[model samples]
Target: MQPYFMPYLGYFQLARSCDQFVFLDDVNFIRRGFINRNRILLDGKPFAFSLPVIRASQNRPINRHSFAGAMELFLEQLRHTYRRAPFYGPVFRLVESLCLEPDMNVARKAAASVAAVFAYLGLPLNYSFASSHPAEGLGGECRILDICRRFDATAYHNAPGGRHLYDVAAFRAAGVCLRFVKGSFPAYGQPGAETFVPGLSIIDVLMNNAPERVSRMLDDYVLEHA
Candidate 1:
């Protein structure tokens, strides 16, 4: 699916639940979508963190977009916002290393940063780029089906919002099972008595809890047949 901004725990759950996770970077419609922004809580208030993108032709690979000019500003914002977090030091160091590494491929850099974070937290999954695949004109359900076929996936899993867009009948006709992710809140080790904010970015959890605690939080989500 499309890359979302440091997406929620459920997104990682979906990634781990599948065999091969595809990043739909080639899709053009959701330019301003979560790929570059995510929500975080600071001083008990909700806020969004985003990255500035350099302009490029539509045909340019998402992995090629650059964040050169805004790197320092973005790092400063993250440091200022998350400095008080319980896991701030370690997370900040990781972010610092990734952001400063010499790389003009902005999309790849971001993807690598995300992968590194997930890896640090012990979530393992094979990630692939949709642009690398031989997709010509697939869209909507057809696109999902194409991925399923390419990966030999008998089941196609997606987030809850997918129910509104996925054609279940068509998938059934193609012999692929459709499934939706059901988020189980208040996963083990989540902060006690705190007002739960559902669907915030994973950074919220990382900042509020330790790595082991976050691992327990993974248990809170389940995949259900759609």
Candidate 2:
């Protein structure tokens, strides 16, 4: 997975469910995707927050893109957005620590957010970037297969969104099993909403609920075999 900006609950679930995650930061950066942006709750409604990247392009890799501007406005937005939530103090601090890091590369920033959340929840899974170890393949499925083989993996787990793309026979032939994780955001109280909006960023989850509650909620998903 490419690093995402304070990704959704399902992203954390996918990480926690794995022993290790290889963030595919070396891959081509997808526009209009979750690489540098995520949905958060603002004014009790869904709002998208994006980390502006400098000269981001599909031709270039995610790790090559850097952040565009000072993070003050982004910080202010988060502070104003979740200030009144139940876990405001802790959540704000977490976001502050992660986003304000000196590293301005978008991949590092996004990965920092993921690491911060994982640490906050005491999740034990480890992670590395895809660029660190180049695997042999040129395209999507072949690249994924090469990655799995490079790590000598027995099984591969992907987000449910990749259901159509990952072929069962291909993985089986490589002596690896494939599975997809499906997560429905567990029902939780938002500060000012009558009905909860689902699939907001990890920031929303941290703001509205305690870490322990979110930790428990992380397990509220099913893994389907391919």
Candidate 3:
């Protein structure tokens, strides 16, 4: 899966369920996508925050994309939005550090943020970049198969959205079993919100809830045969 910019709870659930996770850094950057943007709860509503890419081309891969946004400005937004959150102090620092990182590439920055959050949550899943291993394949499914083969993986797990993209027999032919993960993101309290917003970033989750609660949320998912 592509590394996302402060992705939602489902992303963390996928990471937790996997033995090793791969971030697809070699793929083209999809503008206005989760790669550079995510929803964060703000004043009882879901609001989007984004990292602007510096003169990026759609043809360029995620590893080649550079950020053109101000870290202070972004941090200020987070500071005000999550001020009342229980874990704001720690999460704010982590988020600030990620935004101020020297690396400009979207993938590297996103990977750094994910790693930081995993550490904070004590998640033990191993993660790597797909670009680190040069791959040969065309379509999405073929490319995914190549990744599975590279890891000598006996099984592959993907988010439920890709259920149609893969076939059971095709993966079996490649010596891999395929499965889809669908998480039941139960509604949780957000400090300032009257009603809960389901798809806010993992940061939002951490800020408002205890680590134990968030860890339980990571386990609130079902894996289906693909």
Candidate 4:
């Protein structure tokens, strides 16, 4: 999957399910996609937050994009939104580091953000950037198969949405297992809201729940063959 900015719980669940995670950073950027933006809870409703990308275009791959200076705005927004949240201090520090890190390339920053969360929970991440392993001139499933072969990965796990894009029989024919993650995001309390707002960034989860509690939530998913 392409690296997403502080992605939703389902993203983490999918990552956790994999033995090796590969970011599709070489793919063309989707202008309105979650690659650089995601929602967060603010004022009892879901608020979208984004990193400004310099010269973002579908013609350019995600790794080629650089983030413009706007993380401070995002950090302030998080501070205001989750100030009263239960696990505010440490979570804020984590967010601060994620945003203020030296890396400004869109793909690397997003990848590091996910890595930071895994580190906070003491989970090991064995991940790579797709561009680094150049499957040049290949596209779609063919490119994915090449990646699997490079890693000697017997199984390729993806989010539930991937079921539509991949064929179980074809992958099986390639000596690979095709599986999809069905994420169960158990509802947790959020400040200033009685009705739960689901699918916000992982930052919201960390803010409202302790790292240990959030670690348990990572396992709240099921895997099935696609």
The best candidate in terms of lDDT: 4
Choose the strongest candidate by TM-score. 4
lDDT of 2: 0.85
- Residues 57-146 of candidate 1 have per-residue lDDT tens digits of 456656657664466876776676677777888877777787677774655665675677678788776898777785787776787798
TM-score of each: 0.85, 0.96, 0.95, 0.97
Q: lDDT scores for all predictions?
A: 0.71, 0.85, 0.85, 0.90
Candidate 2: segments with Cα more than 4 A from true spot: none
After superposition, the stretches of candidate 4 with alpha carbons farther than 4 Å from their true spots are: none
Worst 10 residues of 1 by lDDT: 187-196
Cα RMSD (Å) per model?
3.0, 1.3, 1.3, 0.9
Question: Each model's number of backbone clashes?
Answer: 1, 0, 0, 0
Q: Alpha carbon lDDT of residue 117, candidate 1? A: 61
Candidate 4, residues 1-226, lDDT tens digits: the string is: 9999889999999999988999999999999899999999888788988789999999999999999967888888988889999889988998898778788999999999899999999998889999989976999999999999999989999998878888778799999999889988888999887699888999989998988888888988999977
Residues 61-159 of candidate 2: C-alpha lDDT, one tens digit per residue? 888999885678888988877888899998898888776777888888888889888788887758988887786556688888887887889988899
Q: lDDT score of model 3?
A: 0.85
lDDT score for residue 176 of model 4: 98
Better of 3 and 4 by lDDT: 4
**Clashing residue pairs for model 4:** none
What lDDT would candidate 4 get against the real structure?
A: 0.90
Ordered by lDDT, highest first, the candidates read 4, 3, 2, 1
Worst 10 residues of 2 by lDDT: 130-139
> Sorted by TM-score, highest first, which candidate order results?
4, 2, 3, 1
